[model samples]
Target: MSVSVDLATVWAFIIAFAVFVYIVMDGFDLGLGILFPLFPAKADRDVIMNSVAPVWDGNETWLVLGGGGMMAAFPLAYAVLMPALYTPVIAMLLGLVFRGVAFEFRWRTRRERNLWDIAFAGGSLVAALAQGVALGAILQGVHVEGRHYAGGWWDWLTPFSILTGVALVIGYALLGATWLVMKTEGELRERAYHLSWIFLIAMLGAMGAVSIVTPFLHVQYTQRWFAWPNIILTAPVPIAVAGVSALLLRSLAKKYDYQPFSLSLMLFALSYAGLGISLYPYIVPQSITIWQAASPEKSQLFMLFGVAVLIPLILGYTAWAYWVFRGKVNTASGFH
Candidate 1:
């Protein structure tokens, strides 16, 4: 048997896959943190923490893989994007660190647990919002002079970016709620189910908000989405998203344990696919493309060989971790 694939495309797909995995996996943990206040009960909160405890750190491994791969395979993009996104990227790292520390400290400190809980929730919110804002900035187009970001410090701060930040919060909350439903039972599960319904509405509203604003920000997307033949070709992405969203709602209403989370993941995957279609070759929205921003072909091919080996090892361990920790968490199951 023979297999043929463009090494650059292969690397691009690898990075994208890592990012998607991080979003689906760590998104739930972040969501759980975002929902900390809503749980009210200490025991319920503990269960929420424990449910994600085993996999949260491992989930973030995808972030490192994605970032490192981008730097290695698309050095030009890394050169431009990192400087453009310096502040938000730093803020995200700080928030992640704060949240990780809060996780450990809260377990140790009885009287100070509330403070740590606030830190955890706040950190998650900050990190999620920063990511969304950075994404919005990217979509709205960055100021690039040659291969570098020539934008102002506040370029990432805009009404559209802020809206995206809120939308991500709601989306993460929805993911978290569905996760709780899958990882818990009894009253906590019921509470999570109800919360998911609320998050679902918010998520829809966010999507509408983004859709309305995206076309105005980039005329190319408007043309791609609304032009005659292109419209016909792209129609299925939105239609599929709608179908998945409907299934998500139905799954939540039916109180199916795993289906809501599964459907939510599907919705995210569809949204990601639509975004990829809309962006196509562009690594930096309207500006730079993958081929242009990509590092040397020789370097990409070399890294591809390394990634080919590394990815399977990571995937194998991730799968094993999930299998070991599968099933509903309880108050007694506290983080180990």
Candidate 2:
């Protein structure tokens, strides 16, 4: 039997899925960018770049799709959200651009490698900080004036936002550290494994602080987590995340080389899944439900047909790229 479905629900799911992919894919690479400065050797650094350089550009495409889908499917949300976030958005874009340019031009010219290295690291920090701020604002809820945000510029950069910023920095570092455990070996790999515990602990502490404070900031969040069936549904997320993190720490501490990184990756995935589920229905988080934020069903239907074609093509190309470059990086090699 065929069932009639709400088109806005479908659009919401698609946008949400795309956002998930962005976090899962680019999240780690951005983690790599955040951790790029830690590796002390030139060859080891190449290996870290090797882990993400081929896929980083492709990973970022999900963000574009997610954001574009949001803008097209919910023009009202876009109108309100973008202006409120223009400064951080601009900074994020600039950071990404600067890092991308440095990534390419850096190899092309030997003379400016030092300068470009600084740019890459600096760009990573800026982008990560802006993203964290944007996320914090959403979680804390913006001051909505009719259809617009009525908050000060400084309002977005609250202590909670700053905490999230540092939290993500450590989280990205955890991703990178785990990545190194998987991809590199010898002392470099050992250092990465050891560092993961330290950073993971830091990430846990930050998340703990946020969990305590989030409920006080908004009533709906309190109800969502603390009330009735929602608590039962949500309890598994934190429990699972904790279990996985503990296992990952145990493995890394024991110097279990092969699966430590993968486990850490799984832990990250589970945590992000909880976040997506928690924030479901709210594109702007409590300000607007996906249905209220949606464009006409006709618009989404047209977009869906195109997305169905383009998404698979993107997946295929990403797969092919990984297959073609399926080896560790070396400083001796240059892009051909």
Candidate 3:
């Protein structure tokens, strides 16, 4: 209602949008990395690598933006969350570092290409799993007492967190496979289509498991979803997510090359919306409300000016990179 309240809420939404963009964009390339080891043929793997090479770095820009935005706009949340999630956060960064290094070094090595390939795939797997675990740990809730994490070091390693980690692996694999379906042609495209279906089924199973388990783990979340008027308002979120998934499955079944990828993006959007709704007004799940976590209004407004300028530039060049590299990856051209 007040100016500061509006500022905090706006910043919260901005941080969420940045995170959503990162997940959808980086998710596919990370998916590609995860799929690297699947195709045994060296040439086929080269094409897959090339398909993502142009935009992979640009795709990661959103991640930096998201982290930086949160640190700037909601410093308290960043402080509390970072310590609470230190282990997985470190693992994720290490995985990403391995992925980036392997992506570049693979092109240069003649005898050691295989080693890099293994690293790429392994890195992707670790990063994806760590991210998922982090998500589950947050959703299951954190232990905070007077602005500090109160849980043990191994609190993030629970069975539910591990399950969520596996789900994220499937989800990212689906995103990658669908992306390949869009950008590739001939045998690779066909292969991608097949993998997309496999990953889709896996994703469905994971989502179903997480869906069933989430409410039982978090009473507030359960009440929010099932309580009369709130349930009426929120019911469409899951339904829309299901519809998107169905559309993706149908597209894959029909062998509609581009539609599967587009539908996957829609699915990501809906799922993110559902997540944001479920955790509304809370930057650190149930522990810290947005207003409690937000920096001063003047600080947020100052940061907003920079974000407004930077986001458009980031978007423009990301679009340009994609447009420049549009088309099926030509394997014969070699890794550049």
Candidate 4:
């Protein structure tokens, strides 16, 4: 006998894949901006910005896909979660807008360059923080009475949310430092290696804090992680994280160009997997599930067809762009 397939689960994974791609792709550039203040010289900033200039905007395609796919494939989750998360969502969008504008305008002017640089860093910082807080708010649980959200406006704001926000900032900064280590040369690379040591330690601490706090936020999370038979499957995640952390530390210490960035991405992927373990089946966590929130089967089928065509095209172009732009970004002749 053949098993039945679930479209909702497929769509859920698709969205998850998109979001993860966005985090890793756009993440490094946002990190570059966050680390902008540390490299105050004009030449350093120019090289930093140029490293990502070819592909920064394209990276946001996944963000749009993730958000739009959710609204289409999981309308109920969208309806309920939006109202509950409007503040951070809006803040995230605004931050992206400012960062995008700064990316362009910063190159066009000299006198006003510093202001745009500030905007670039500030916007990146805000976007990363808001994303983390929004994630924490969702993980902590949203108030749902019947089909609609019943929470107050400030419901998203909390100590847990704040902690997650700070954690993401540090994590993105780590991604940025590692990217610099991979893509630059000489003093910039040296400084990035130093910063990587600092950010890696900070990122680990943040990850530990989030991991420790997560189980207590819900009994289900505790059961999923620590309860009996489940631990057999879940145990390897942390172990793999430990192994990867050791490799990353060794890579950075040895000053390997590419391994640091690759290892950093692995750490992020593991953390994301841990998150999925905590909140599987439930799109809204503690409330709505993927099946309950999914659109009609016919609607899902129609959209899946579109996604099949769209995703490959996206992957093709994205891969081509990166391949074309591959290798170290030279300070003498930038992308611009």
- Candidates in order have lDDT scores of 0.87, 0.76, 0.88, 0.94
Regions more than 4 Å wrong, model 2: 1-5, 330-336
Ranking by lDDT: 4, 3, 1, 2
State TM-scores per candidate.
0.96, 0.91, 0.97, 0.98
Per-residue alpha-carbon lDDT of model 3 for 92-178, expressed as tens digits?
999999999999999998899999999999999999999999998888888899888888888888999999999888899999999
The digit string of per-residue lDDT tens for model 2 on 170-242 reads: 7777777777676666677777877888878887887778667776777877778789988998888788888
Model 2 lDDT at residue 335: 33
State how far residue 282 of model 4 sits from its true place (Å): 0.3
lDDT of 1 by residue, 209-292 (tens): 887788777789888888888988888977888898988988888899999999988878877876777777788888888777
Ranking of candidates on TM-score, top first: 4, 3, 1, 2
Best by TM-score: 4
For residues 234-278, could you state the per-residue lDDT of candidate 4 as single tens digits? 999999999999999999989999999999999999999999999
Q: Which candidate, 3 or 4, has the higher TM-score?
A: 4
Pick by lDDT: 1 or 3, better one: 3
* Model 3 vs. true fold: TM: 0.97
**How much is 162 displaced in model 2, in angstroms?**
1.1
